[model samples]
Target chain A: MTVLDEIETCIPALRRYAHALLRDREGAEDLVQDCLERAVARRTLWRGDGPVRAWLFRILLNRFRDVRRSAEGRAQLVPLDATVEPARSGGQEAHLDLREVHAAMGRLPFDQRAALLLVALEGMSLAEAARVLDIPEGTLTSRLARARETLRRMTGRAPAQDLVERK
Target chain B: MSDNLPIDDEALIRLRHGEPADREKLADLLAADPSLRERLAEWDRQDAALATLYNPLADEPVPARHQDLLAAAARAPGWRFRWPERIAAAMAFLAIGTVAGWFAALHQMPGPAEADLATEAMRAYATYSVEVLHPVEVPASAASHLESWLSKRVGRPITPPDLSGNGFRLLGGRVLPDSQGTAALMLYENDLGQRLALYVAPAPAGVETAFRFAQSGAAQGFWWVDNRLGCALVGDLPHDALRKLSLSAYDQIDQT
Candidate 1:
């Protein structure tokens, strides 16, 4: 199969990832479709050296960033539906509490969220993600650290502890 | 307690790496401090919620029309501004026409096969196009389910074409019969109103090695034989444009 054909198979996964990241179904699919078209048109120039999936993802993430940057002043959050129940039962009432978390996630600077999601959701290794994001590994680590801290504070979680215990 | 706390940046970096040993160390540190434990629990809750929010959206069905649109767009012709290439495309059509005439002269007694096949394909195309309420026996949105269902009916394993790159998404496929016998007609469309149909059947005896193109009124018909399968791509587009679409369809079907 041609590289174009191989890239076609990755669309569903790309769409899913984009949708999750954008939280808008139509916008996410459009981004993935556009990315696929760009990839296909550039297939001849593609070096076939790196993982195609990662390369496609990088294109997608970059497109998302561009859109986010251009629409900075116009960005609006979709209010979470209060009626939907949490997936799991917990005394903390994760469903109600999660709206705040989602908002906080949106509020995070794009680089931090991209780094955090690349690791936590997409399951990319730190090095792989750093390569995809075109940043130094140290930079990725710092972004992830800041992201977690921001999330912790937003969720009303206490600060990190200093106690140590031997394993 | 304060002295025992591992630095926040270090612990977070470790957690992102999925280092369980670091988590254990952090957990130990948090356990000694009530406020830190509470914070860690909150972070865990946030992760859980984020996962929940995104996971289900991935499984939701992409609208059928979007799949159709992508499929159609992929088949659209590439931009060409050069006169020589346009002339070459014209010559290709003339060559195909000449070949068709030669075949017609050789056969003398024309059978209804070509006409019948084109009509069947075009009819199936039109039927599916207007089908506002159930165009395909199996919708492409449930691709896995459609694969199994169409395969069972056709008595052969069939994989749907991946047209995402062409801007055409597989909306799924269905089995339809023509005057000739059982045929599989896969429906695909694009954001534009264009739609392409793939008509497949076992090749008739002795007629297993010919590539034929027929323009039926406004629609273009492409038929070819590869081993035992008779494949045709019928669509309402220019002949050269149709060939490119047929080639893509052939690539997709042949791979499957």
Candidate 2:
């Protein structure tokens, strides 16, 4: 596929990831736009061996970090409310009720959130996510575990204990 | 089963993925402790929920802001030259030599080499003007970011001249190293889509010139040196128009 086509295909995923990270629709869009422009401008930098999706996500992740860092340094941070999109908007399964899950996600450390998004929402393998995040796979595995455990604990709503009777 | 099963995520993920040994061992452990399977399945539900919440966003149309950015990127490079443009450039070169030679003589400036420096700036303008891709590294929409970026990169403070008053708005800028010092290339375009570039750099201790003009082929350039900064404004516009741009750029970029 052409670079533009590849980029277009990745846009939705990048937007989803960005929105999750920033929790502000406009801010997420702005961040993804910057990532797209930078990727296009630096297309030559990509060796073409890896999946374009992974590369784009990597760029998006790095841009988020840089912008977040500078914005934090400036102390002009706009507190991101997690209700930017109420999960029920899509008629998502009411059983899960994951808005609290998202709230817990927002409270996750950056690395843990990033690692979880790569492995969970994006369905990337541990190795692929480790490469994209520039972290060792062991670190990624640990972060994912921590993120999952924290979400479960904070939500206090996992159905695991009741699953035996339900089944 | 618990005696041999690893509790870490690595083993858990392996079991989920059906990696044989890990899955077999984890399955035996799961049979013994049904809660293990339930907990892993619960984690799956949570991840599934998160995905369902976010997947819908991808279906939304890309915003207008991003579409504009893509269009600008498509229009990024300014350096494609057609046969007609090349022919016109050849004709302009002759005209430039005459204008540049006479302009240099009129100045009767102390440094002969500085006149050549003006020609060098003109060359840089020529090199980048015909570019259809990757003209200036940064796009003009981020003018302040471009300014700070070029400034930090070139190790010189660069205040890109505002030419909107002269019917030109900045397209963007890039940095170059010249014999004198750090040189910056800032590109601008007028309403007619006509492009002009200002090449600015520090002048050597002895190299200095008043406003001078140069052309090679169709490109005409006007340049001057003040204190430490040497400035050149080049374009395919008329000699008078380019000259005015040079002087205007000088005023806007003057550090003092």
Candidate 3:
């Protein structure tokens, strides 16, 4: 398939990752739109040697950083932690509290959250996530481990088996 | 506090995320410490929770604005020349006032506010022209329906211009939100799938202007006001070609 078609297949995953990173629906969509525009505009610069999905992810991460830096410079940055609306009503809410999970995600550093979301939410391989973040695989691993620990501690959740028993 | 363990939390996390690991060591670690399995399962549950929270976003249809950006960019030249070329194009485009004086003596140049008609038209063209599943709210097959619906909504007697002579068949049209009340978008496509859009909206009566050209990247537009209606014809065709098509569309709309 053409590069555009491949990019098309990656949009849903990109949106999911963007939403996970920003924790804001409109911002995530706007970020995704900017990402797609850049991806298409620079379509020629992307060599087909690597997976286009990774390249797209790389573009998105870079764009997010640029936006964050500018927002920080302006002192108008809405803390990612502050912007997460509570989980909407009507979910199963059986075992783990998704709201707690989301809040904990917000509290994590951007790097850790990005690594965790790329691996767990987008299901990218560890190496792929590392490439997207332009970090070493070891760094990616530590970030994921730290993110998981922070999340567990912040959410104050027991082991999975314990949650099941409580349910 | 399993930092000293050869199979530490990082290793387990890596394994959970599908990184290749020393399986014999992991299995032995799991066997020696049953709690390791619990930790792995907890991480999996967190992942499950995340999926529950955000996966629905993936299933949501991508908004039309994004689709328009993709369509416009895809149609743009493969190698973008960046701002310099764009600025030069803008200068060249603005210089058309001299050409305008000769082309239509009676009409005035569109001021910045009035130029929104062209911008809106280009935006609508970028959006609807690339739609694969639903290009238009009403299809050309229902010609009369499209005409009457758009006419009534736009509060003008509107009809989709016949451009078959220009080798473009009427594809269909849709009503779009306009800053000045309602606007109508009629689409036409050639056999090669190249599409064009005509945007029509209400303008003050007793005012008329000749065609004014505007270019944004690959999309070119020629907008004019006549018969109390503001109209813009937008497409990705060559400048002269689109200009010709716009004049033809103008004559057809004028006659109707």
Chain A TM-score per model, please list them: 0.72, 0.81, 0.82
Per residue, candidate 3 scores C-alpha lDDT tens digits across A36-111 of 9877765544435579999899889977886775566475534344333333232223457878888788877788
**Ten residues in sequence with the least summed lDDT for candidate 2 chain A:** A83-92
User: Candidate 1, residues B74-161: lDDT per residue as tens digits?
Assistant: 5647541132243344346545666555445544332466446666777777777667677677777566677777667655566665
For residue A136, model 2's alpha carbon misses the true position, in angstroms, by 1.0
| Better by TM-score, candidate 3 or 2 | 2
By TM-score, the better pick of 1 and 2 is 2
Query: Which segments of candidate 1 are over 4 A away from where they belong?
Result: A1-9, A44-48, A68-96, A160-167, B1-5, B18-42, B63-256
Model 2 lDDT per residue over B139-216, tens place: 876666888987786566787875654578788998887776668899988768888888877766655455666778
Q: Per-prediction count of colliding residue pairs?
A: 19, 12, 0
Q: State TM-scores per candidate.
A: 0.44, 0.53, 0.51
After TM-score superposition, what is the CA distance of residue B150 in candidate 1 from its true location, in Å?
52
> Which candidate tops DockQ?
3
Candidate scoring better on DockQ of 1 and 3: 3
Instruction: Residues A39-86, candidate 1: write the lDDT tens digits.
Output: 554443333556777878877886666566566579754333332222
TM-score of candidate 3 against the unseen true structure: 0.51
Binned by DockQ into CAPRI classes (incorrect, acceptable, medium, high), candidate 1 is incorrect
Residue range with the least summed lDDT across 10 consecutive positions in model 2 chain B: B79-88
Positional deviation of residue A118's Cα in model 2 after best superposition, in angstroms: 1.3
Candidate 2: segments with Cα more than 4 A from true spot: A76-94, A157-167, B14-33, B71-256
**C-alpha lDDT (0 to 100) for residue B142 of candidate 1:** 63
